[model samples]
Target: MKFKLLAAAVSSIALASPVFADLVLPWMSYRTGPYAVAGIPLADGYADYLTMLNERDGGIGGVPVRLLECETGYNTEKGVECYESTKAEGSLVYHPLSTGITYQLIPKVTADGIALHSMGYGRTSAANGKIFSNIFNYPANYWTAASAGVNYLLNENSGSLEGKHIALLYHNSAYGKEPIRTLEGLSEKHGFELTLIPVDHPGQEQKSQWLQIRRERPDYVIMWGFGVMNQVAIQEAANIRFPMENFIGNWWAGAEHDVIPAGDVANGYKSLVMNDTGSEFSIYDDIQKYVVASGKAAGAGDNLGTVMYNRSLYMAFLTHMAILKAQELAGTSDISQAEMIKGMEALEITDAMMAEYGLANIGPAFSVSCENHGGPGLGAVSQWDASAGKWNLVSDYLVADMDLINPLIQADSLAFAQENNITERCN
Candidate 1:
C-alpha cells in the first residue's frame, strides 16, 4: 500500500542522506487568506503532530522529522514559490491544502520526481496511479464524495432517487466545480434532476443563489464549499428556513466554525467526512500531553479536537505512517527522496494500523496499489447536532459508485496521459 509523496534522491542505500539529517516534509499551508479562518486550525494540527512525533516519539522511525512550513496564503503562485524554495531541502513529499495549488503542482512534482499527496482535494482523476505516477490522492477524493452524497440520498429515500431534485450549491472555483461532473453522472444513472448553483470567491454574497434555491426547493442541497463560504451558506440556508436536515455539506464545510456562527439553526445540517470527528480518541490525549501541554502547540491551541484540526491531524498521522513504511522499504533510517516515494507507494493503512498508532477507528481503512492511487473512496455522513455543539456519524463508512467512477477516472487520466505524453505504469 504505497501512498503518494516520494522524492527520488539518494538512489541507493550508499547514497542515502547523511546520518541524523532531518527528514523534511514541506507544508504549503495557508494561515492567511480568504480561507484563513478555516486554514488556521488545519495548519496547527499538521504542525503540532510532527512536533508531537519529535516530542512524544522522538521522531518517526528514530529519524528526526522536520516540517518546513511555508505560508501559501491560499494563493497558487505562492504555493509554487514555496515548493521551489523548499524542494532543495531534501524534502521527499509535499501536502498542499489548496486545490488550486495542487493543480499547479501536479506537473511540477512529476518533473521533479517527487511525491504529491493532494489529500482529498485536487484533481480527482489522479487516483489513476498508472497515469499520475508521482501524484497521489489516496483514501478519498472529490468525485467519490459526490457519489457518496447521492448514495446517502438514495439510502434516505429507501433505495430510489428517480425524479428527485438535487441541487449542488458550490463555490465557484476549481475546487468547487470538482464534484459537478460526478454528480451529473450520478444524476443520469439514478434518474435524478440535477441543478448547479455557483457562488463566487470568498463567497460573501450568495443571496441570489439561496433565493433561487428557495424558489425551486430542491429535495436535497449538497454543498461544495469552504472558508467563510461555509458559515455564510449555513446562515443563508437558515434564514430561508430551508430544512437543515435536507442540506448536506462536503467534509470541508463540516467544522464547528461552519455551524457555530449559524447557531441552533444549523442543527441537523449534514456533511460527509473521511476521518473520525470526535475528540474521544486516545491520540488527542497524546497530542494534548506531547504537543499542547508541552507549550509547543501551533496557533492558540484552542482548535484541539475541532473538526478542521482533526482533519489535519489525520493527514499528519498518515504522512507519519507513510514515512515509516518508506523507511522499512529503503532499509535505512536516513532514506532518500526516491526511497520516500517508494515507501509511499507501498504503504497500507488498516484498522489495526490506526490502533497501533494510538488512534483506533480514526479513519477508513485502505490499501494503496499501483493502479489505484486513491484508496477505497469510502466516507461516512455526519450531522451537526447544534445542541451538543458536535458532529455525529449517522451512517457507516459508505462506498462510492466506483463502478461509475472508474470509467471516469480512466477516460480522464488516460486522456491526461495522452495529452501530456505520459506512459501508464503498473499495467
Candidate 2:
C-alpha cells in the first residue's frame, strides 16, 4: 500500500492558510533496504496506529493528526533530507528511528525548537534530557539493555560477576556505541572483564568477529549488531562451538529476519527483548479487524505482531499517548511544538493503557520532565528457544543498577554539553 506524502520541504513555509488545525508528525522509515525486513513492519505498525486513532477516535485531542512517511532506506543522509523536507508544515515532532539519524539531526532539532521522539535505540547518552533539550529517549535506552544484559549473566551465575569475561560483537556505528559506555561501567564496577568487537555497517560478513570470540573465550557474548550482522553473529557462534544459549543480543539484534536467515542454526541464542512478540496480542486483533480487514493495514497481515511490527506500534503508541497527555495540558486541539513537548514530558503509561493495548508493561513506571528524558530503566531478558520458535521472557521488568551508571551518564552528558556548548533551561 502506498502511504501519503507531502512533497514540500520542512523548511519551506508555503502558507495556504491553515484549513483545519491538525497535528503533523513526520516519519523517517527504512522500508526498502538491508533493514527493511525489520523496518517495513515497524513502519506499518507505527503508521497504522495513528491511522487507527484518527479513524476510530477522531485524531488525537479531537483534532485530525496526519502521519507523513518518507523512506530513508537506512541511509543517514536520506533521513536528514527527509527531516529537513518535512519540518516546516507545523511538524510537532520528528521521530527518526535510526541512531545514526538521531546523532545527525540532534543539533538541528535543538536549533529548530522541535522535539525529537527517540524513545528507544539511539545514543544512550541522549537520554540526558537536560543536555539534549529537544531529544527525548524515553522509557529506556541502550545502556539499560547493556546493564540488564550484564545483570542477566550475573543472575545466571548465581548473583556474582567477579571474574566473568563478557564479549560484545556490535555494529560499528553510533547505534552500536549506545551500549558500550554502560557495559564498560558495569564491567569496572562488577569486576567483569569486557571485550568489544566491531562489525561494520550492514553487518554481513563476520567470519572474523566470531573468530575473536573463539579466541577470547568470553563467558558470554552480547550482540549489538543488526540485520545480516545478527544472523552472522549466531552462525559464527554456532560454528565456534560457543554454545548458542550463552550468546545474547541487544533488542535491535533480535528479530524474525535476524534469526530466520541463520536458518535452523540460530536456535537457543538469547537476546534482550523490548516488548512482547507473537500475533496473540489484542492490538494485533484490532489491527487485523480494523486495519487489515478494512484493507488499511500498512503492509500486510503476515507482519503483524513480529518484533518490528510491535516495536513500531509501540513507538507510535507512545507518541500518540504523549500527544494525548499534551492535549490534556494544552487544552486545545491546536497543539504547538512547545505544548507537545510539555505533554510528552508529562506522559504516564499506566497499567490500564498496557491492558488496553494487549501489551505487557516492561518498566520502572516513568514520567518525563524537561530535565530527564528516560522515564525508568525497565526491560526484560528474553531467550530464543529454537524448538519453540518464540522468545521466552527469562526475567521481569527489572531496573538496571543505575546508581552504578548514572555518574557515567552525568560525566558523558557533561562532556557532550562541553563539546556541543549545550545550554539547558528547566521549566
Candidate 3:
C-alpha cells in the first residue's frame, strides 16, 4: 500500500537551531472507501488544528510539530501498514481513527512503546489503563456512550424503561458490537426487551433489518452505525414512518453527514455526544483565521464547522494537551514516545484549561491517570433538527454509571492481561 505524507514546514527559528527536532504525530487516517464521508472531515479537522498551531502558536511548547498523514482508506491491513512504516519517524503518538485499526494496533503499539490515543473508538476495556498503559480513550468510551444513551432513554420515558422494547441496529463490525454487553446489562437492569439487528459492511442496504423493526415495532431504536449506514438507517426509519423522536444513534451515528443526506425526514432523530457540535467556539474562530482563511485547511472549507469536524478538532485539542503535558513533565519540548505515554497518563483537563484552550463548555473536563485511561466518561444527548440543519443539545452532561461499567471493564481487561501475559502497571 502506498502512503501519503503531509509534512508541515519547520519554523525558521527551529531550522536555525540544529539541536531542535520536530515532534512527530502520526495520523492513521482513512479518507476513502465506504466511510469516507465521515473520515474526511475528521482527518481535515485534525490536520488543520496541527497546522493552526504551527502557523499561529509556533507549535506546542515552542517545538515545531511534524504531522504525518498516512491514508488507510479505513482498511485494517492498510492501517497497520501505516503504523509500521511511520513508527520509526520519531513518532510521539498514534491516533488510529478506525476502531478496527485501533484493535489491530493495540498489541503492536504496546510492543513498540508508543502511546495510542484511541479517543472514543477503540476497545472499551482499554479504559483500564493499568493493563493497557500505552492506550488512552479519554473523555468517553463506547460503554459510557451506551450507558448515556440508555440514561437519556430512561429520562425520555419518565425514568422507567420497564417493558419498553428497544431495538439496536448496528453495523456488523468490532465498532458496532461494542455496545452489546453494556446494552444487555442495561436491559436486564431496566426490564426492557432488547433486540439486536446487524447491518453488513458499507451499510447501504438494511431492508431486512427495518422489516424486523416494523414487525416487532420496537418502542425505540438505538443505532450503532457509521458513514452511509447512518443515512440509510434514518431513511429506512422514515420509510416505515417510525416516529423519528423514538430513534437515537450512538455518537458515531450523529454527525452532520449522517442526517444531511436524509433531509427533513431525519428531524427529531437524537444521538449521544461527547463534545459540542457546530463552530460557535472561539477555537473555531482561530481555526478559521489561521487555518481555513489562510488556505491551509486539509479538506474542503465547507465542512469547517460541522459536528464530526469539530469532534475531530476536540480530539486534536486533547491530543495537543497531552503532548504539552508530556513536554512539561519531561522539561523538554522534544520528547520520546515513552515521555508521551507519561504525559498522557498524567494529563488533566480542568475547566480553566478548557477556557484557556478555547474549548469552554464543549465537553466535560476530566483527568487521565495510570488507573484510568478514559476520563470521567461524561456525555450528553443531541437532537438533529433537519430544518435548522444542525444538532442541538437536549440533555445536560450525563455521567456513565461506572457501577455497572466498571465490573465489565475489570473482567475484560483481566482476561486480556492473562491472555497476553501482561501485568497491571498501576495496581
Residue 177 Cα positional deviation in candidate 1, in Å, after optimal superposition:
1.0
Worst 10-residue lDDT window, candidate 2: 1-10
Q: In model 1, where do residues sit more than 4 Å from their true spots? A: 1-18
> Residue 367 deviation, candidate 3, in Å?
0.5
Whose lDDT is greatest here? Answer: 3
lDDT for every model?
0.89, 0.80, 0.90
Query: Using Cα atoms with residue i matched to residue i, what is each candidate's TM-score against the true structure?
Result: 0.95, 0.91, 0.95
How many Å off is the CA of 102 in candidate 1? 0.6
RMSD in order of candidates: 6.9, 6.8, 6.2
Give one digit per residue, the lDDT tens place, for model 3 in 163-238.
8999999989888999999999999999999999999988888999999999999999999998889999999999
Q: After superposition, how far is residue 373 of candidate 2 from its true place, in Å?
A: 0.4
List clashing residue pairs in candidate 3: none
What TM-score does model 3 achieve against the real structure?
0.95
Model 1 scores a TM of 0.95
On the 0 to 100 scale, the lDDT of residue 53 in model 1 is: 93
Instruction: Name the lDDT value of residue 132 in candidate 1.
Output: 94
